[model samples]
Target: MTSLDMTREALARAERESAMKSRILATVSHDIRTPLSGIAGMSHLLGQTRLTPEQANYLAGIGQSVQALSQLVDDLLDFSAIEAGRFKLHPRDDDLRQLIESVVEILAHRAHEKGIEIASWVAADVPGLLSFDPERLRQVLFNLVGNAVKFTNEGGVLVSASMVEGELEIRVRDTGPGMSVRGQERLFREFEQVGEEKSRIGGTGLGLAISRRIVLEAGGSIAVESELGVGSTFVVRVPVGQPSDFRLRQARATMLSSTHMLIIAPDGVCREALAAAVTSLGGTVRLAATPADLLASLEHAADAFTDIVVDRRLADFLSEELCKHPVFRNPATRRILLIDPETRSTTRFLGAGYDSWLVRPLRERSLVGVLQGRMKGIELRDPINDNRSNSRWTQAEGSGLDVLLAEDDPVNRLLLKTVLKKGGHRVSEVETLRDLIAAATQATGRPGAIVTDLSMPGGNGLDALSAIRDFERTNRLAEVPIIVVTGSAGSETRKAAIDAGATELFVKPADPAKLAELLASYAARRAG
Candidate 1:
């Protein structure tokens, strides 16, 4: 009780707290910086020149390194936020149906790659409108779904939701190596894993911990059930109504049975491609090469069309008019403006009351994702072959080959070039879609497979693929294989690239070794 005794005890406590803070910061920095360094270094290496096919693959492996590192960093940040009780919830009225669809769309590609099918079933009994934070819900679900996909080596991940006694119950089930009793008990503890195998799989092990915190904060509860070597299921239950909660009415309110899509572009090829992609997605697409034709079409079908999608160049000419027009002013109709990456100005479109902004070459998946997000009831069918139950291609050894590299980022281009070159493949580089076409046409002299980025200025990888297909149709080029590379492997983007004629899709920061193996396989196929 003495003043001296109190001061001594207080000093010790402060010192202990400071030391713990220092330790935490050091661990986080190491965890975050490791993968970031790999991403930057490998990306830089890939941009170099004169790379062999094998070397190019080594650079691809760098991307996987970055992803693993990024996940760890995110887990740490989320854990910290939860522990501080500083994590805030911004709840809004959301359509649970749409939210589940969005999560499925995001994770579909990864599941497909693993030969796993993901099916979602939302119970009709569950209320369409619920009060919750969309982003937080997405984050929580993403962690669960992502874990399901990552841990499962066979079967698939299924997400289903229903209402049970006034509570919304969302379940994520996966057929993978299941957890043990001890694993289940420690699942929600920070920096903890069930076993050695899990630690090697590269998780910071904070996903379940963060999920528990978020669910609890939202007045919800989460539980897990699993059996060894069979599968696991995670269930989240949250109450449906609270007086302060905001409710999002069903998307069916704005649903359209038929949709009209207008693609306005100066280039005929680009216009046709956009039209085709839209049509493939169950929309009636109209191509307008000029502003006059576009305007005429809009005016003629003012009431018939449910939505209007226009190129950025054409958007400028029609934005003001569309906003003031009686048809667009109606709440039922929606407008989406498409901009080329080169056009950075968003001021004009925002002023015109456009519902969304899209950038070219507008991957089909992204477009559909945006549409599905904006519209309430339009359902999107699975793009992958669900019946195909084959496992991923086995890892292969390097077979010296030639590679055609197409990318816009100077750093990424150089990095890929370096890696491929080191792997012992002859590498040629191109920056634009036009150049890619030219290179493919001239491939007879230096025949090889193509590796291209999805997004590029002055045309893109998909455009180049279309041109290559045309050349093949005319017998001007051989049936050379192509790989599409991208940053965000959204379900829509992957499906779009594949539908556009890519042989395989690789997400950014991919493993270089895997890229090399793919190239080697292409070479073997060409020889066979």
Candidate 2:
């Protein structure tokens, strides 16, 4: 046989193997996630009901386990797609700082449990918005930071982003036991775990491999620098497309030009980053690491800062004292609290003379908005007098909607129905495409939103969605929000759903809380 013919045969075999692997992964993903969706859904329901402390803890553990398993499935699926050359990057303009903050926020609980701090910093020069695939970028950062947190016990993990020569560079540095020379060589290889404590620190070792593929696909490069006893830092550099408008930059500069701000954060990195951002935007900044420093600076300084941003942790120490502080009470100065997302007693803080609150790890756009007075502060209402019925934040249990749910599986259907009902929504279920189309089109009253699973028994959800869209257009009706919740994670699947007029797409085992939030937002938008 000719050499060319032999090469062709070899290529054919490889292609067949790749296709088979992708198909197997898809099957595995669906099978595992189908059950996981039920488990996660039920746990979420259990959480709402009154439970003993022990039961709550057990439920939390179950939730975490489900998340871990789902993550594993996702990792395997992503790797398979990359290997099969089916991985695609969908880049769009998004808030880079917000994305980084979200990843850090998600992992902060774990870091705090291990007595380690996890923080993020985006360079002042890095535009507030950049063109990139936010979800894919999030996945890469999550894996890198998660791995860093898992391996580190003593110090902490710091994820920082900077713009270098028009390329977006992200560095994840950890004070963990670093890799040796030999270990570094195989670090990005599939299923390769290094270090003596590899068993103790568990992972499938496909994280770096998958991350590398994602970065490379985005026309980027990822590398690591490490020493045996010191630490490891993973650097990812990717070329970004359109940044925020130059006119907006000018506006930011103009708004902040006359501003003098005070930033109080215990974390040194965060404190400096805030100062840098402010300084870059043509503002003057003062840094205080402690309450005492803040007080002293206020007392000694001639001019009062226009804005005082206090970390919620430090505010706890100040407590009632903050309300009495001269600088905090000054009408000329805005009091902004840098709050953790899990902080629930915010009403008290807001009542105690805070003008506004920024959820930490802070996003640059939010900060700019707050500082510029473009983002309005919460209205100071009497806590006792305020029933909060009229407040924008009131959604769950406050208002309900008519929902049409399409799912073939009983367990999955129950999960969706329960979640919607729990949020006070009236749900109508349909198990087949025929029923779905009939209910959506023939019904007298329109549903506020439609939640559907893509792969039904007889016909696909996409077909039903397309039909619904056609019906809407034919009848000159307002388009309903058609949210697709599917097990398929393929880019093609996502594109197809969007093409079929799906309002949004969510992978299976979607968080009930987030789903509810989405519905609330949809309602809110419509009402507005």
Candidate 3:
């Protein structure tokens, strides 16, 4: 063969090897997660039962262990996929503020346990809906924040994201013991751990390595800055891909133009974030470091401020005193509290003369809406507990629909069935592709929804989905929502499933809570 022919053959061989590795990894991942899902599902069910404190601790331990194991498995598979050139990015349009808040929420428990605060903020200029892979981006944030929380003992961690130039810049700053120059140099190396107390902090040490690779693959850069006695900050900048439907909505949302506000935030970081948000929306703002400062500013200023935004910590200190003040007593001036996420209730604020509240690491949209009196305080409710009384869920549960579930594994099938039953749905179980197609096409009445696994004994689930879709079209029947819960992690598998008419695809082991929520939504949609 010629040199060019030889090179082509080599390239083809490498592609084939990568494809083979991808298939093997998918099978392995699915097999491992299938059983993990069973454990997780049973754990969820077990927690719902009444138990002693000791039993609850044990159950919690099991959950933590399972989560750790799952993370390990995922990390190993993700590294292998990256090495084999099989890693893929799934980008979608989602709110940047929501993404940052989610990361903080996930790590809030850990930070609280350590007696430290964790918060995030997104600049007003950042578009609400940015095209990015949330899952992958979140993974990087998790590693950065998780490490920061693990090391920091006294101070807190603050994460902020902004649109700088044409890139999205994410900054994760932690008040932990600073790292040495050598430690920073070796930070991104695979399986290398370096820090002041490396011995005390236990991890696979693959997080930063994987994160670096992910960022580089996405045409982004990750860097760090630290000093011996000071803390550290990890900054990641990625190219921002605007969605096809992108618009400068935030720039156009100047409804707060006529609003004048007095802001009081003791925390400098939070105060600046709030001020930026307000001004970005065309509102005028004056900052105060304390209640006295706020009072002094109000007393001297000739302008009648339309709004008063104060942090809950400061408000708690002098709520009564501030409420009695002449300027504070002005009924027209809206009082907005910057509440910490852990504040379980808002009733105390009402009694303290506050009219509205906004959660910290404030989003620009929420800030604008609250200033314009177009939005209400966001109430943090427990989803599982609230579902019992939620009108939508109640309506769906009161008159459940027939749900068809397809899974070759008995354990997964049983787990899914239990979850569906708990949601008040009647389920018909099928194990093979042939049976899935038959049950789906031949049912006397249309199923409320169908949940299936991609890999089946008799045939491929995608093929079954295709056949079912054809039958539905041919018979002029309404299309049923088919949710795919599989172990496959290949992008090709996800693409094929979507192309074959899958409504939603979840990789195993799917959270029982999320799966149930998805089912409930479909039922509710149909009922509506």
Candidate 4:
């Protein structure tokens, strides 16, 4: 054969192999998930039953196992999809802290079982809101943390993130067991668990391989460090654009001008992190390791501190010991508690007597928010509320109702319908443009919102959107938010949808929580 002919044959063989792998993975995914779903469903139902503590624990373990199996299947399919050139990234603006928190929470149970502590923090300079593929970023975090939890038996796992030279550097460090210099060579390669880790920690061994692919695809790099018994740290560095790429709620410039902060944290590293954040916010910081030290610092200070920041661990460990301390009781001091975002809630901390609290892996904007509010002696809110668009709806008012769903794909329609139903929304499903028009034009019992899929029969989704807008205008009706979800979101298609009046456009596999949040916001606005 000629050189060109040989190259063509090689390419053909590779294609054939990829197709076969994809088909096998697809079949296994369906077969495995069908049984796993039933197991998860029954286990969920069993969990709601009144049972002894031991039995409840057993049920919880079963649920975790099922979820682990499901995750493995998903990983396999994702790998196959990527190899087949089907994996796509849908970037959107989201809070990085919230994304990390969501992943940490999902894997916390496993860590807790091993008597491990998992804590995460972002550098102060890192923007709280940035544009990225949340789902992909989340998968990367989940794999790293899950591996950390799986291997670590003692000490703790830390998810630390920082922005360095235009890249977001994330490190997942664990104190469980480390690897050797020679063994690190095969870590990121496909199906290679390296050394004895494959036996010690049971996994399909595809997690790191998939994570590297995702990180690289997103214009990032991932690396690792390990010593035989010293545990390991995996570092992933991804370009997250410059600070201007973020939606800045508060200026990066120090807002803490002339403000004084006293940080009391049990972890020395945490103390330094807090101090650095305060310094960036244009404030001076004093560190305290104990309540006694705090009192001495307060007495010796040239001026009273504008804020007293305490780690929730330090405050609660000492119980009322700190609350009764003269420094804590001082009228001039505004108390702020630093907490792990995964395990801590604002209500819990607030009830424990902090005026306000900041989630850890502290962001500069969040630090400024807490300090700024306290400078004025106002009640402080979580950092998440600071950057997220504040929805007017309180929990009671945010309840969704009577949503009109337009989609031709039965599977997607049913899946979304069940999700909405479980979230307390009454869904009216329509497969055709006529049904959608009829539903929208109903004389009474209006839907709270309309969700439509593009490329449906009988009409273009953009046209349907325009018709809906025109109907609302002609009939003197209240504006109902329209959500467009489609597989194709070319610039022209997006512009067309927006011109016709779409509130938001989501590509396939949109986050359900986001969809619900949007719907709730519309409901609350209309009610207001």
Residues 145-244 of candidate 2: C-alpha lDDT, one tens digit per residue: 9889888887778888887888999999998999998999999999888777654354788888999999999999999999988999999999998655
Give per-residue lDDT, candidate 3, residue 253: 43
Question: Which portions of model 1 miss their true places by more than 4 Å?
Answer: 1-60, 195-199, 240-528
Per-model TM-score, in order, reads 0.43, 0.81, 0.84, 0.67
lDDT (tens digit, per residue) of candidate 3 on 1-528: 999999999999988988787668766777898888788768776776677778866876777667766776777788878888768788888777887877777776667667776777666567768888998999899889988888888767888887798899999988888899999999998888887555435477788999999999889999999987678999999997765433465554465678888887775446766776667667788888766787788787778889988787777676666756787889888888887666766887766678889876555557777877888676652322111223232233436768999988888888888778878898888889998898899747767799999888998778899999999999899999999998775667789999999999987768777788888888778889
In the order shown, what is each candidate's alpha-carbon RMSD?
21.5, 5.3, 4.0, 7.1
Q: How many steric clashes does model 1 contain?
A: 36
lDDT of candidate 2 vs native? 0.80
Worst lDDT run of 10 residues, candidate 4, spans 381-390
* Top candidate, metric TM-score: 3
Residue-level lDDT of model 1, residues 388-470, one tens digit each, is: 21123222224456788987777667667665665666788888888888878864564477888766767766677787887
Q: How many residue pairs collide in each prediction?
A: 36, 0, 0, 4
Task: Arrange candidates by lDDT, descending.
Answer: 2, 3, 4, 1
Compared with the true structure, model 3 gives a TM-score of 0.84
TM-score for candidate 1, residues paired by index:
0.43
lDDT of each: 0.66, 0.80, 0.79, 0.71
Runs in model 3 deviating more than 4 A are: 1-24, 47-64, 90-94, 196-202, 243-260, 268-272, 282-302, 381-398, 443-446, 470-477
Number of clashing residue pairs, candidate 4: 4
